[model samples]
Target: MKKTLLISHNREKLLNALVYFSKSTRFCGKTKLFKLLYFLDFIHFRETGRSITGLNYYAWDKGPVPQDLFHELKQPDTDLKETIALLEQSEDEDYRLCRVIAKKPFDPKYFSRREKKIMEELSFVFKDALAKDMVEITHLSGTPWDKTMKEKGPGKRIDYSLAVDGSKGSLSLEEIKERMSEIKEVTEIFGDQ
Candidate 1:
């Protein structure tokens, strides 16, 4: 299937985020990386009604996972392989570290000011935290992951739109609704460009 403009943009964002976290964090593997992306997207979504990466996460047993990117990591795409690499997990680490080995340095051009701020915040907050710790965070009650696992069952696509209903680190429900409407309008306007 062909990717939409937003989805294509998401891939680049993901790559840059991988590099950012890889450089800044103490330990980040696939599991930790997934949680980071989940938190970044959901937090931003809750605040601004948009995900940093237009990724659709699944409520996997571990936590929320962006399955499309998960698969891409499994069988490294040629372009991606040239830019990044998921190193083999050592006995010491819970997950394999994603390394940016590309000749081209990380570019933050695709990210908005808010997006970059969120990424930096996530990296700082979870820098030394373990993958299990990140998992615990995602598994919190009332979160999108919890709602999906309890209401829709696991392995289902997590409806991140549900994020607007929560109160923690979130705007008021009424405000969220307004942002959602504004985002929808903007998306419709720019979707085909």
Candidate 2:
């Protein structure tokens, strides 16, 4: 498979997000971190037609994972080593437990207002959820992860469009109609202007 560079990737933006989620008490772990980033980028892309980090996610058994981002975090000389090192890890009966040890404030410069807003909201919603809980949430019906896993049988690229359809990743007829109506209203108001 051909590797694609995240043309718009901003390393600072990703680290900033890690910093943000690291502050959350509800969720912690490498898996959760990956899921949080995936949600931030994909959900932002769905709403604005642009990704915040421009990272591509693949359907992994754990959930949607940013492969490049993971590798970047694992680099010996990574600037984030100090922060990443603070992550606490322990062996659980079922899965490994991971948590941030040294949480720091995220730099707002790396994120847009919309992106930050979404991140904050997601952080709050999943704050109390566990890593395994996050994995289940990512695998919920209509998600890009689920769609790709079902169609391509895992390890396949999950298109970002799936995030635009809503959390379930599928739009009901009523929701579609509402969107169409909203669009018509926008066009009607802006068309004459």
Candidate 3:
């Protein structure tokens, strides 16, 4: 039997669709379904204060915000400062998507098991580079980091330090992701060493 989380609004329609979708041979895992439901819940919560309850008894109040819900609620906005404050105070884990993905509302756990395994392999490769002093990692956590980044866009801000080598003067991972092609173009204009 497929697990389901039923929200308050559009119950009959959503349930009917979910039932049909669940029977498909192409159906993905419960995690994927949870993600969709979670996002819907977040939109519901933002538009109205009520969170999705009664989904096979897996409730946000009882545990971490559903991964999809966490991702949806973390998007950047004009009220990002206030939203971040609300998120920090809530049950969601403080996932620094800006650092990892250069976007808000990233959920690593949303990836398929195979995809996550590939990411783990890539992570080890990157970690090795850092260990050999070829790359550096930096981490930003807590309110101070959030405040700084809020004032300065991710492109121009450095929030947390994971690894740094002053000799290289390279961009942080966040910056690299944010300005991938731009960095190359700018460097070409300035002439590479």
Candidate 4:
């Protein structure tokens, strides 16, 4: 599928987010990391009409997943090469678990105030939650992932607009359309990077 997001996936900011979550929370595994980014992007989009990461999430069995980033992290020589590393830790080892390690310092300059605030909140709230805990949260009924899985089937792209009108959404239908139009205009002008 084509990367239709107008704003390119900001790798620098993503790396920083990873670092921030790694330092601020204990459950920074591949699964939990994806959920955090999902909330960050979807919540931000629900409020502002744009996603922070410029990523399209898919309805994977675990929940909404940024599949591109997922694949890259599972292999070597991706964008995050030196910026971060995933350290395997036994789940039962309470004292020695750290799934992700930041090789670079966190960069706050790449994030906006709202974005930073949301990340901080997510880190704090999910600090002790297990990866499966996040999975359950994202899989709750009426969520974009849940809705998509039921309506569009698995592997389908979860639309950002759903965050605006799904069960947790607060915006009206017309407002959502307007914001989506504006976003489309900006992306059309900028095109895909």
Candidate 5:
């Protein structure tokens, strides 16, 4: 028997990822923050069949946006209230860019080794790139966002399944076994209804 895997979303991980990017540059803008997070989650999922942030990425007008995270950022008293305060909004033409404010270093306990590695690597890659460049890169054809945008236009949900589409062999043996065990436990408990 097979069962859907249980997924847990961690706000701490989200904050760590955001802080990692914000720390790498002077002030990571809104678009860059979204794109960085998208990469962090999607790439991690591709390699491990699980996202670090556990966010659902949607094909929005700009690019792949995490709907839940976006909603939380809009709220003022959420767990992310401190993190939200660090974002300084600026109007760039018709777009609003959320620039990051300097804050104390984020605790590292929230991130796994793999998640941390991906975040660092992505931050380095996009260190000097502009937000518009990130948008173009994320919108490349064959990406989940591209496919979703093509089929349903903007504002559609970019299926999470796309992250693992070509990542069957990306996981190490240990990771593969761990995933299998998790699935087995779920199926055993549910027992096919």
Candidate 6:
């Protein structure tokens, strides 16, 4: 069956918050972490109309660097180029650590060993979220596109796909609504299932 996915800014906020908390020293318990990750995967399932793999890829590919980090770097006085260079010099596992330290006003050494350990654990949260996204997308691929022809009619096919573009980071509700309305207009013109 053909389906229409509705994206929501609230859901995106929740996911972003989850990522933030996962990396935070205050909330990195194993049980709570898994629960938050799964909840985010469920949101991805609903918003994109894709299965869990979509959430996995979304988290894996786009989840690491929070949107706020970029915003902070964009400030007029911020030394973005130097900070990026420092991040690049760090090992893969330490990239987020470098980023967190760079964004905050405190010294990097101020983060205790325990806090650093929490950050490492939180990295897995990111990985799991990405894995869920991938699984959902892979499931969708199994649904043959051509089958729509025989099942729904000759012209019936997927008109648009709900793909996540993380390059822009999370969007506001107004932005999402505007895009949804635009898509609704197109669907009306083309006829809907």
Q: What's model 2's lDDT at 95?
A: 62
lDDT of 2 by residue, 96-192 (tens): 6656544356678777788889999998888888888889999898888999999888888888666656445445445545664775686588651
Off by over 4 Å in 5: 1-9, 84-96, 165-193
Please rank every candidate by lDDT, starting with the best. Answer: 4, 1, 5, 2, 6, 3
Q: Please, what is the whole-model Cα lDDT of each candidate in the order they appear?
A: 0.78, 0.72, 0.31, 0.81, 0.73, 0.35
Per-candidate total of colliding backbone pairs:
0, 1, 9, 0, 0, 16
Q: Candidate 6 lDDT, tens digit per residue, 9-58? A: 33333333334544453323322333344344333333433322122212
lDDT of 4 by residue, 100-188 (tens): 88888887988999899999899889999988889999999989999999999999999988887644546666777798798788779
Candidate 2 or 5, higher TM-score?
5
Over 97-119, each residue of candidate 1 has an lDDT whose tens digit, in order, gives: 54334335678997999898999
For candidate 3, write residues 143-188 as lDDT tens digits: 2223334565343322222112222443445554455456457658
- For TM-score, candidate 4 versus 6, the one ahead is 4
TM-score, cand. 6 vs. native: 0.22
Q: What's the true lDDT of residue 92 in model 1?
A: 52
TM-score of each: 0.81, 0.74, 0.22, 0.84, 0.77, 0.22
Q: Which pairs of residues have clashing backbones in candidate 1?
A: none
* Model 3: residues with Cα > 4 Å off, grouped in runs: 1-14, 20-27, 52-193
Q: After superposition, how far is residue 22 of candidate 2 from its true place, in Å?
A: 0.3
TM-score of 5: 0.77
Ranking 1 against 4 by TM-score, winner? 4
> Least lDDT summed over 10 consecutive residues: which range in candidate 1?
95-104
In candidate 2, which residue ranges exceed 4 Å CA deviation? 1-9, 86-88, 102-104, 166-193
Candidate of highest lDDT: 4
Q: What C-alpha lDDT, on a 0 to 100 scale, does residue 82 get in candidate 4?
A: 73
Assess candidate 6 and give its lDDT. Answer: 0.35
